[model samples]
Target: MLSIKVLGSGCANCKRLETRVRKVCADNDLDATIEKVTDYQDIMRWPILSTPGLVINETLVSQGRIPAEAEIARLLKS
Candidate 1:
């Protein structure tokens, strides 16, 4: 299973990113655990200097913007 974490402060973009991530996982039929890290401290711990970070299996993959569903699915598959 893939462990994915979205780090953000629960803003609109954050929520959108979360929703997109869930949809990507579901569409891809991926067994992933998607989590939202809303706490600032937790978000900061991931070495990302921007909001809406994506962490896959403890490896930080993206930050600052919402990645496309296809990209997310590719990441999850990898």
Candidate 2:
């Protein structure tokens, strides 16, 4: 199983990123637990300095933008 965290300030982009992540996971049949990190302190634990950050298994994968489904699937696989 994969642990994923979507970090944002509860904005539109954040929600969209979360939705895309879930959709990609479902499409690829990946078993992932998705969590939303809205608190600034919690989100700052990662090295990301942007909104809509993505953390996979405690490693920061992306930030500031929504990643493509293919990219997300690749991340899950690795």
Candidate 3:
């Protein structure tokens, strides 16, 4: 299973990102563990300068903005 993390402080964008990740996983039938990292310290460990970060398999894939659903699907496949 893929390990996915959405790093943020529970903001709108953060929630949206998490939702998108979940949708992608569901649509593709991908097995993934989606986690939310809200603690500042925990989020910083991923080298993100802003909230709404997306991490896949412990790798930082996005930050600072909400990505499109198509882009998210692509990321998951990678």
Per-residue lDDT of candidate 2, residues 26-74 (tens digit): 9988888999999999999999899999999999999999998899889
Q: What are the per-model C-alpha RMSD values against the true structure?
A: 0.7, 0.6, 0.6
TM-score pick, better of 1 and 3: 3
Q: Which stretches of candidate 1 lie over 4 Å from their true place?
A: none
Global CA lDDT computed for model 3: 0.93
Candidate 1 global Cα RMSD: 0.7
Per-residue accuracy of model 1 over 1-78 as CA lDDT, tens digit each: 888999999999989999999999888788888899999978888899988899999999999999998898888888
Q: How well does candidate 3 score on lDDT at residue 20?
A: 88
Q: How good is model 2 by TM-score?
A: 0.96
The stretch of ten residues in a row with the least summed lDDT in candidate 3 is: 42-51
Better of 1 and 2 by TM-score: 2
Global lDDT of each candidate: 0.90, 0.94, 0.93
Regions of candidate 3 where Cα sits further than 4 Å from its true position: none
Cα deviation at 36, candidate 2, in Å, is: 0.3
List pairs with backbone clashes in candidate 2.
none
